[model samples]
Target: MEKGSNHTPKALEKMRQRKWSKATRAKMQGKSHSAETRAKMSASHSGKTLTPEHRENIRKALLGHKISPETRAKIGKAALGHTRRLGMKHTPETIAQISATKLQPENRAKARAKKLGSNNPAWQGGISREPYGWEWDEPLRESIRKYDGYKCRVCGVPQMECDVALNVHHINYAK
Candidate 1:
């Protein structure tokens, strides 16, 4: 509509005259648009790309939006096994990006610091801090690693491939 013509007396009269009845509005409430209308709507949005600023605006708008528990559960249930690459491996670039992200020990500490002691799932009422008559030194640990061919006893990962030292747990846990 022409900007100045929209609120003209004739246009106001036309709009007031075209108001739908309550019954007509009720009938349209649950009804969808016709195929032609849907096609026109789709065409109007086709080939339109959001500008970077618009995309940033959208991101900022949704930054702190919270989903209710029920909505989150529904979304999770709907998303189960629906990934485009459900069972595929991450590409090398993704793996590199992930490794780079995890390279900082400070980030790992900051994350775990929130869930230590009583807040942790394996808290065990602080029993983990109690030594179970076990006092193996670094030399003993090295011997155990040497005995195990310098690789992970379970997954068989080589010691050199591990970022940290190989842990040799007690026999009960080594099982």
Candidate 2:
């Protein structure tokens, strides 16, 4: 289908509900755009920028969408054995040059500044450093662990069987 074509809500809903048979899907699998068509498509989108309203609409549409496990597995299998820049390596001299550039005082200061306090994009005003409530004591934690039979809730692995310590996580972090 062509990009950004307008359709009625009913038509769009119908399209969403429509499913193609395997034969139809197989027939379309290896199709490629003609050079002229490709040029036209490129020209159509060359200078387009989505408006805030359009961007918000797209965000809302995709807000809670999830990939099915079958689709996830297909994506994983498709990417298997792919190595980006395979066999590429920096020479010792090139590594030294890179190290020297990064170690320069100005470069070090810039990197440090990016991660300092509220200057960091991810800073949350030290909220994460606040202590847990009084109800979240070690005894409460141990009781919860015992209630769960001392096993990982997600993987069902017993604490005794795991190489690392098990932790109880709050699924809903509303507080």
Candidate 3:
């Protein structure tokens, strides 16, 4: 007969009926999913996630779609080139189709820059900027030379190859 007594049961029912989004479910189950279940889920989820009927409908819709012959040729050429460059025996037709799609110039440049950046020493686990309190002294420099085989560890061009004398680097200057 108490008005506030209803609130406690209502809140408990609401908590029991709580629904978690897929992301929240995933995070809550973090690092605890069984390997077999995880593998099954991963394999099942490895697609566009469209139903067969929906995909068929989309296919029917695009049945009359047209692309320029020149665009088609460029895509085929690029796919073939990729296969040759990668030494791959087979290039997926789906990959060719995706590449044929239009992309912004900036997006293309960013992709190219990313690919190039991966090859650069500074980006590929190489040190950037001078170390704190870096200095050159006889014992320290000799230790550096010995540790690095008298070569620049970052650029790998060799300390002897450097026009400027290489300096000894301390990992923790405050220490």
Best by lDDT: 2
Q: After superposition, how far is residue 92 of candidate 3 from its true place, in Å?
A: 24
Deviation (Å) of 160 in candidate 1: 44
Q: Give me the runs in candidate 2 sitting further than 4 Å from their true place.
A: 1-30, 33-61, 83-89, 115-175
Question: Candidate 2 — worst ten consecutive residues by lDDT sum?
Answer: 166-175
User: How well is each residue in 1-175 modelled by candidate 2, as lDDT tens digits?
Assistant: 4789889899978776665656657776989889999999999999999999999999999999999999999999999999887999999999999999999999999999888999888889866535666577779878878888889888888999988667877434443
Model 1 residue runs over 4 Å out of place are: 1-28, 34-36, 85-175
C-alpha RMSD values across all candidates: 15.6, 19.6, 21.8
| Residue-by-residue lDDT tens digits, candidate 1, 95-173 | 9999888778997888788888898877788665366334556887799889899888788889899899887883358
lDDT of 1: 0.82
Rank by TM-score (best first): 2, 1, 3
- Candidate 3 matches the true fold with a TM-score of 0.21
In order, candidate lDDTs are 0.82, 0.84, 0.68
Query: Could you estimate the TM-score for every candidate?
Result: 0.30, 0.33, 0.21
How far is 123's C-alpha from truth in model 2 (Å)? 12
